[model samples]
Target: MPRSATDLLDLSELPAPQRREVRDFVQFLLTRQAGAKKPAASYRFSDLCGTMAWKGDAVAAQRSLRDEW
Candidate 1:
């Protein structure tokens, strides 16, 4: 509920280990924010979509999959 960084935490009053935990949490937030600001990596599945060539009978394949054999 703190409005500013200075008011956000009393790191001085925290034990050293707890202070380190806060520092780590802040670092994680910063890194997460940085990642959010950037565009995500893209993937191109189109190139691999139809790369495999099927030589068998198409209708037979469909029927077999339906347990219609």
Candidate 2:
């Protein structure tokens, strides 16, 4: 038989301040877990395909960068 969390941890043995800290930590963990179950926001790179504006010569820019290296 496995021992449950309540049985394994005797919160009564801890001081009042420490107990409150533990309680706050447990609440944080629960909130984090609930958030984890939610689906993450998604992004599409294709949506930004033609959003950029370029004004200079592409090959000239490459040669200029290479010459500096």
Candidate 3:
């Protein structure tokens, strides 16, 4: 049998309600993936896409500078 990432994520040890929560959260994350370089995700209270912008390594370097420290 082939094992996908989600097949193992559905741990049988978890309770029914907890299992449902896990399933829903996983689906939510899949939907949130906006085909960007960043792995950032946010929840939407309203029916709107929580935008994810991917500013790459330049931002990280700036943040790590002495002035930022």
Candidate 4:
């Protein structure tokens, strides 16, 4: 029978160096997959956005609060 893509690995058959190489490749693929995920839409946070926009110097107010902390 043909082995499925998810067939069990026989790491014991691989040389130590080859096993390390395979492990590194798997990690690389996982990292690439994580970064390839689509970002959320620009309007995803639209509702919570303008909720914090005030007319005054919000940056100065934030700095002052941070200094107090």
Segments of candidate 3 deviating more than 4 angstroms: 1-4, 34-69
Cα RMSDs of all predictions?
A: 6.0, 6.3, 13.1, 6.6
lDDT of 2 by residue, 1-60 (tens): 986444556799899999878877877887899899999979787697846677999999
Score candidate 1 by TM-score against the native: 0.53
lDDT: which candidate is best?
2
57: Cα error in model 2, Å: 6.9
In order, the Cα lDDT scores of the candidates are 0.80, 0.81, 0.72, 0.74
The pairs that clash in candidate 1 are none
Q: Compared with the true structure, what per-residue lDDT tens digits does model 1 show for residues 11-36?
A: 99889998888878887887899899
Per-prediction TM-score, please?
A: 0.53, 0.49, 0.40, 0.42
- State the lDDT of candidate 4 residue by residue for 25-48, as single tens digits: 877887888778967556657567
lDDT of residue 10 for candidate 4? 73
Give the TM-score (vs. native) of candidate 2.
Answer: 0.49
Candidate 1 vs candidate 2, TM-score winner: 1
Please write out the lDDT profile of model 3 over residues 1-69, one tens digit for every residue.
896446767479999888888888877777676455576678675557566666778767777895675
**Which segments of model 2 are wrong by more than 4 Å?**
1-10, 43-52, 56-69
